[model samples]
Target: MQCSSYWFCPDVWTAVILLILCRFRGCVSHLKINKYYTIKSEMAKDFPTRAENYAQWYNDLVIKADMAENSAVRGCMVIKPYGYAIWEKMQAALDKMFKDTGHVNAYFPIFIPKSFFSKEASHVEGFAKECAVVTHYRLKNDPDGKGVVVDENAKLEEELIVRPTSETIIWDTYRNWIQSYRDLPLLINQWANVVRWEMRTRLFLRTAEFLWQEGHTAHATAEEAIAETEQMLNVYADFAENFMAVPVLKGVKSPNERFAGAVETYCIEALMQDGKALQAGTSHFLGQNFAKAFDVQFLSKENKLEYVWATSWGVSTRLMGALIMAHSDDHGLVLPPKLAPTQVVIIPIYKTNEQLAAITEKVDIIVKNLKAKGITVKYDDRDTYKPGWKFNEYEFKGVPVRLAIGPRDLENGTVEVSRRDTLEKSSFQIADIETKIEHLLQSIQDNLFQKAVDFRENMTTKADTWEEFVDLLDNKGGFILAHWDGTPETEQEIKEKTKATIRLIPLDARPEEGRCILTGKPSSRRVVFARAY
Candidate 1:
């Protein structure tokens, strides 16, 4: 008998009969079937929108884009190759800036003696809770053979503190390296990993261990050291604005918010899409603090001995989190053209080998031209995945410009271009396509930066009274420009009440007579306050 319905075919009827017989014989006591089932592609799963769940959306994007993931070690992360490539780009740009400023790269030991921390009392107190200490030198097999255990007999005479910041150790080394007026200006930078032992950790934002570059400079006078500090701050701001395409506010940190042993802390703060601020970078003026702590002194031009002035500045992988939150949408990452690892991706669509060969032949010329123009281009001609899959993959990975050429396009001597920033697609003649792609990339970068700038401008607002400050923080959730009494007690009180802290005191803030928003005390100028990451 022929089946009339597609769902109830002859095979279906046969299976039904077999099931009935098996059930009657108690052979299939519990039988179940799905009327219909559809397998969803992993790449097709949508992320939670920012409005729905901003935190989840960010976590999903980071993992889905193959950027990073939590590692076996708690509070630590494994930065995948794709994420590291972006970081490498940032390092390259900033490294050149450092070199231009007469800074040379150097290496410092990872393990610092516990005594080193004791040299700087405030520094030790600041990092004591977060430090990871090693008391034993070796581990031995367990007596029960379950696992290994720290060998008590192998304990060291002095415990070692894993380097949190290299101020103490770097200053100690500087003492030996500098002794006279000729070795006055010692500019050095080190690229290394540090362990902070954070209690709460996010993938890249607050990891226990992360990668960073710290610059430690020693100068003959305090004026020169301050100049170096400000110069590095500008470098960070430039890198953030130009390469990362994230707008930032340059300013000084309040005493409570300043870096632990620094006399003054300068920072560039960037606002994220979720209306929270993230400190993008910081440059700290040490003001002979470390030099005095380590007894690092030099012979002056007047034949007198004096302690050297010092400065330390650094930006960590937390900038990765800033980059992700600043501009990425719910769809996926929208990388700036300058920092995108694979800036241009070319995908060929074809049904047969001959067609693919023809498309590839054309793509090879396009790739060659793009490479000659110094563009990082990828030609994805793999037959394992369909054209649609490849398209979604690159889009999610934030490839700035995507070019697709099918047989029809090949015949017409044109290619379809898609810009990731806007998800806009258009067809253009393949003639001089290299120049077109380059211009499109620049336009995307500019658009992303402007969009961020506009968002920040809209989110920033002024609050006059304590009520207004509390309302703005609880309801609007952005940077609030308000008068502070310039006292740590008031800062602490505001934080305790509203969970908002002063983000920065603007460098160019004009002198405007005002009253403190919280205490109604006299104030000089308004400070930027925000709930930050």
Candidate 2:
């Protein structure tokens, strides 16, 4: 039998492994000494500027800011504590909104029986390429090799697929729960991780596994289901604008882009700093498709049996990517006040331990007052790092506000306040520091949103002719409002030529007579188009 023992490795190979790890240890020690500051400094030296390359800037910021890192598994990421903390803030805000909309949280299984997938033909077709299937029940040591292998004798009669989405399993369970109209309008949501087996992945943007909340609601009629869909879309738009401080366009997806198994899909799209569009969130009007597929029937008030109408809406951690690309600058992340894990970081400046102790005392009082006013504050009094270094670190991490207190400031009864959004610094009196910080945070949030909106408006342009559209796409690279022939053929042809997809047709688009940019066919209204992440 071949040995599975690690000690059986050839001496040369073992020596090579040890040499590599020894080199890695030195690098890791350097990184640990300065923490993220070392990463930021290295990024400053080696990474491309945001203007030079937005994609590289993004990857660099995600890593240097300690948001996330690529995992050992291909197409996967490990969200660092800081990143997960921001995600928790998002979850908390969205959870409140979902609960306010009469939706209750529920848990769903991660694995779906293979049979459930085939029930929805369109869904299976849409997700088939990305599905991760589990074919065997057990693994055993290989008789002829060193490592374990699948146990053929333990293979199951049916395979299980890791959930790409929970619709099939949820609807199958709904059939048993909804026997009467009283059970109609069953609003449930689940916060879960899903696997999509992505071919290529980026941290929060397109990972193989990501965290998200999926809301599935049952309705008595198509009208009710449609209303639920729109309501959830509004919720997402509201959250995006108010909490994330990112303005979004509320729109309907083109037929070619509608969600799988959905009759109509509604979404809120946000323009990124790079002029690309990112889908912040989506709500789908399923319109009885899932119900019909799973035979989820309900008895009506008139004693009639009918299939239930359905809707599903979701927002994922991809919003983290959206937030980053929408508002971040060349320095690093520019997190909104509401979503920042630590909204304010206070650093103490001093030459001696005595000076540090005195500054800490004042910082404690300020922190207490700030916390009382619902501000998340972190006091960095660690003697290992100087105050200037701490300031740069927090700025890179996108803390909305930073307060610095020195011995001179203690005598003056003031603190130097820095706003991350504008990179502006000012001195504020300690008498009402909490109130000042509160207003400053709101100002920073508003400033970031307004800045993004202005950038989007300046970048957006209307193109009446094909030449103009192509020029804008090649040069300006923002949203192009152009007419379409309302045909999939035209859409596909434009995408093939320009690599720009119809991000959406604005819900509020006015009717107009024009020609399609690509085919010059008669068109009714314009749609938003952009190259996306």
Candidate 3:
């Protein structure tokens, strides 16, 4: 049966219904092409077209945009090639920076012995339940011969734990790899997969398995290790601001929020366009914790042996989720130029042989010049789709820039430049195309960061009392700066009452005299709190 609005307007119902279904389901399906009009007409009623429901908005953006999809295995994801391409661009940018900073990449074992984890008591306790244990090996034949069963006799005495992180085993190897003070700072980074068995997974945000780069370094002294920790945190902050174009608030996590076994944890927190907080990246200063656990010692220049200080920092595929929620809008993903796989794409709209020939000629020259300047470019000349289809496709893909050339422009000697970030279009002559593209790409990157910064500024609230804190979280839904009693009890109480946790204690936080909002105990300084991803 047709709906009232659609039945009253049958001719446009196809588009309306397709849009409605896509918005409600949060993704357009291949089977819905005939229902586009009707879906679109009712899309607004389903999605609300706002970031007020941030969790749903994020999930919708990731799945609806075709960036990624959930896999058959619970909490796991199949990173489609399109999503992987984005990761590749991110890897290329970050990997180059690591190399430039004198870091070398290495691979680590995916499975660590269960005993290795027991070496660090605190770390083991923190990750025990979340770790995936490999307890069995080969299975025996079933009695009915329908399936194989676990071989009771083949059970092993020891088990292996799929690494949630590589700190323990990496330190164990570092103990042997570093025997002298000369091998002081072993700056090693590993790009590989890690497993964390999360209860609930949301595409890229939380998954059973994900790819990431974990940097583990062992230093001769605590000072050097601390420096490495802070340095990498800064590196993460810089990358978030410049490459991903996501503005982050740099701070040190409170003890309650700190990574287990680490003396100090530094993190960069980013505000989503939806007013939620995502802990983008973290750097931990493990002051003798892992060194003592692994007995990693090095001979000092003074001819004595001393335990090394270690630091571990990592940023995961979750960065992709951060990018989407930080800059993307209802239209689709809006990638920063540096992180976009294709910074600029040329779409030629031509119907006649002369027009096709002219567009092909101009687009080829533009692609060549852009390539010479080290910009990634794509020319879409597929015959199956119209120019309007290609526009929506690239916009959905979030290419940083788009240049459109049609038959009309061929006679005028001009091309249309459409920027992805602002959706702004301007006409330009062929001669200045290269220079103009360079400026537009850089401008898009800058515009994205500034826009996020502005959103963060407007969303952050200062709460002086308990009621105000609850009210701010209930309504405003961003970071709350409030004084704490500096006790776990107070933190837990706030979390129990409100779903907010202490996101971070600013690295630049100052010592002040105040009272805890919950406990009324004398306190100094404040911690930022928000419901997190």
Q: lDDT at 29 for candidate 3? A: 10
Candidate number of the best lDDT: 1
Error of 2 at 300 (Å): 0.8
Rank ordering of all candidates by TM-score, starting from the highest: 2, 1, 3
Give per-residue CA lDDT, model 2, range 56-145, as digits (tens): 788999999999999887778999999999999999999999999999999999889889999988998787777777776655567886
How far residue 12's Cα lies from its native spot in candidate 1, in Å, is 67
Candidate 3 residues lying further than 4 Å off, grouped into runs, are 1-48, 51-53
Model 3: lDDT of residue 189: 94
Candidate 2 off by > 4 Å: 1-45
Between candidates 1 and 3, the one scoring higher on TM-score is: 1
- In candidate 2 the C-alpha lDDT for residue 316 amounts to 97
Model 1 regions more than 4 Å off: 1-44
What are the TM-scores, per candidate, against the unseen true structure? Answer: 0.91, 0.92, 0.90
In model 3, state the lDDT of residue 286: 98
lDDT per residue as tens, model 1, 1-533: 33344443333112100000111111101111111112333554776666656777789989999999999878799999999999999999999999999999999998888899988877877777777777766545567655455557766687777888999999999989999979979999999999887767888888889999999999999999999999999999999999999999999999999898899999999987777788989999999889999999999999999999999999999999999888776568889999999999999999989999999999999999999999999999888999999999898888999999999998899999999988889999999999999899999999989988887888899999888888887777779999999999999999878778899999989988899998899999999998888
Q: What does candidate 3's lDDT look like per residue over 401-430, in tens digits?
A: 999999878888899999988878998898
Q: Where is the poorest 10-residue window by lDDT in model 3?
A: 15-24
Considering lDDT, which of the candidate structures 1 and 3 is the better prediction for this target? 1
